[model samples]
Target chain A: MAALNYIRSNEKKLKVIKSNSITFDNDTKPMAQHQLQPENWVDLYADYLFNYAIGRISDSEVAKDLVQETFMAGLKSAKNYKGDAAERTWLIAILKRKVIDYYRKINSNKGKAEVRMNYSAQSDAEGDWLEEQVADPFSSFENSNIENEELGLAIQDCISKLPKKQALVFTMKTIQGISTEDICNELDINPSNLWVMIHRARTALMDCLNQNWF
Target chain B: MISCEKAAIICNKAQYREATFIEKLKLRFHLLMCKTCSKATKKNTQLTSLCDKANLHSLTENDKLKMKEILQEKD
Candidate 1:
């Protein structure tokens, strides 16, 4: 009889508790949708965004400008923000667009010379692999050794040595692991061009690594 | 019936995970018979993994702070 009385008394309290979450949701809609603070974003994502841009742009000054542009765009679109992605991802997406735009403008003006590979050097006139090009069967290049700081620096140096367009494609595709379709769309290059650039980059890096590490 | 040079290209495409299934099978078949191309493929894959392992290119703290101030001024 005592237990039943206690249960009866708490029924109204349980109902109130059940409705509290609904009341809280109704009150916090605007706050939930509010844009992330700009200052905090600098603390959180500036380095990341800058690095991402610099890797592709290959110039710190230009990279910084691009990041700044991303922030400005973000601020402009803050009111229309939808909370689908994390703020960092959203910022990076904006930065990607800016980088793509920057390249598109550069490409339009200069029509930068394509980095042509001397296929004849690596293969026969008929395009068969030359014995010299395949001189060594394999030289053990271990990438699993994460503690290999020297190897890392060597790779960075090699990447820096690549032609600007090749470096951009290499960083975006190989290092950043961005999709090939996105890379082609962003750089305004076809898939065949992207593949050629990537191939040249890999060959260059391999030769560099072989000379430096192995 | 892909030549070694073509096999090498396909091997590279495979390293980027961009090779078609048929191309991948072709490359695999080529590698099974050609020791030189197989070794080349291994090195190519290693290069990609090394790049992944060495992935810490970021802006300096000072620059980040400067960016923050710059962005703040626009607000």
Candidate 2:
């Protein structure tokens, strides 16, 4: 009788799995593509986009403004979204343009041109060609900055590849440094479950970084 | 005498500084006997340092809320 009951439960579980796969298959169909949830944009992509911006620009206030502008542009261009790329990817493409616009605005500003001319003039009485040709002593610092940005992008890419729950937990615990208890409360998970998720995330991240980074 | 699985759990906990004193001692003993786990621990430490070096920053809560407000207003 116990063995019969076990078989019944196994059948029930299989039915659930089969039905879930059916929905998953349907979701993957070309006609039924992924939908955007604009309301959840801030909760989902804000931090990731902010980090991407700040790493490139290294200015907190401008990064925040650019993130806001990206969302605004995303909303305006919602109809053009093909749903072929993931929502975050689409948003990132917008943010990239926003960042470029920011750089162009600053570079083309009248005040910035005056500042640049003043800097070159202060370097030497003669033409600034020699000053421009000489290698910067602090070039190593710039190189390290580029290296850190690349490393940061690699890590973010790996985190994005994780399951959504695992990514959220890992980011909260490791990157954001939120208290474990707080994460548990927010995610409605127990400590042990959190640890298991963390373990899985760390192991997967290590393997990914080994392949792509190390 | 702890299993490798147990040692790995302890090692992860140690990374967060959440392992108890006894758990850490047991992990140390396990690492001493287990070459594979010791190598893994080293890689895990390297991962931690790399994360630190990356210095990735996130948006503050208020900033995120402001962004949401802007989106809502436009929408």
Candidate 3:
């Protein structure tokens, strides 16, 4: 049936909704999450926006707010959504904006000194030995088999603990899903230097995750 | 003339997928004969995805309510 086709194709969002536990903020209730129509905003996009926030802020509390803010905004703008993308994707886009806005606002209000590193993908392999830079040998791994703790969190911790430059490069490449060239431009590092830093970041993260995640 | 050490550097960026094509071919050719670099590449990658696979945190009920309140504040 058409419904079955939709369900199977949209399984990722469906899985999120089915597994989601909806929550609301206490500040000014959008009063929209409480809307009792068949569509529960929280269940539908909770994990997506929540994950988006966590990825951006890396702080649990702030990430939580970002999700809530996203939902509130989505609720108001739901009519404009138009089902062009998955609900989760739409909500995530909104959350990304909120995160950027948070940084912009905080920067102005605090007026504190901060080193703003612009990440860029303007890079190319230095030369030969690119095989080392090719596919990650372990890309085919089944991480689901090892279940000590969330490897992602453990890795993020290790990444955060890395040298500032290494961490920034690693974060941009992995988390922001940006390119190395862009990261180099953002950090103003040469390709060779970028490779070295990335190596350090990887080694540290690999060790951290291997020891801790398992 | 990628020495084993330089090979290691290239191998490192490869894990991050920052390597170029010919560099990969060179590294691969070396890896075909160099056991040490091959093992290093394997171990390095095993570690990278382990961390990359880590899931981002999710929101809770209290924060959702707070967000609602924030939005409604202006309304």
Give model 3 RMSD, 1 decimal: 19.0
**Is 1 or 2 the stronger prediction by DockQ?**
2
Residue-level lDDT of model 1, residues A14-133, one tens digit each, is 766876766567556655543577767765566567667766787878998899889989998987777645587688899999999998888774447355677566454664457746
**How displaced is residue A179 in candidate 1, in Å?**
0.9
Question: Each model's interface RMSD (Å)?
Answer: 6.7, 1.9, 7.3
How many angstroms is residue A148 displaced in model 1 relative to the true structure, after the best TM-score fit?
3.7
Candidate 3 per-residue lDDT over residues A27-128, each given as its tens digit: 134443323221455544554456546656768777776777666777677667554344555666888899999888778855464665533244453545
**Cα-based lDDT for every prediction:** 0.73, 0.83, 0.63
| Native contacts conserved, per model | 0.55, 0.75, 0.57
Q: What is the alpha-carbon lDDT of model 2 when measured against the actual structure? A: 0.83
Number of colliding residue pairs in each model = 0, 0, 34
- Chain A TM-score across all models, in listed order: 0.42, 0.61, 0.37
CA lDDT of A93 in candidate 2?
A: 96
Q: In terms of TM-score, how similar is model 1 to the real structure?
A: 0.44
Model 3, residue A204: distance off in Å is 1.6
Ten contiguous residues minimizing lDDT sum, candidate 2 chain B: B56-65
Tell me, by TM-score, which candidate is best: 2
Q: Using lDDT, give the best candidate's number.
A: 2
Model 2 segments more than 4 A misplaced: A1-45, A80-90, A103-109, A116-133, A136-140, B60-75
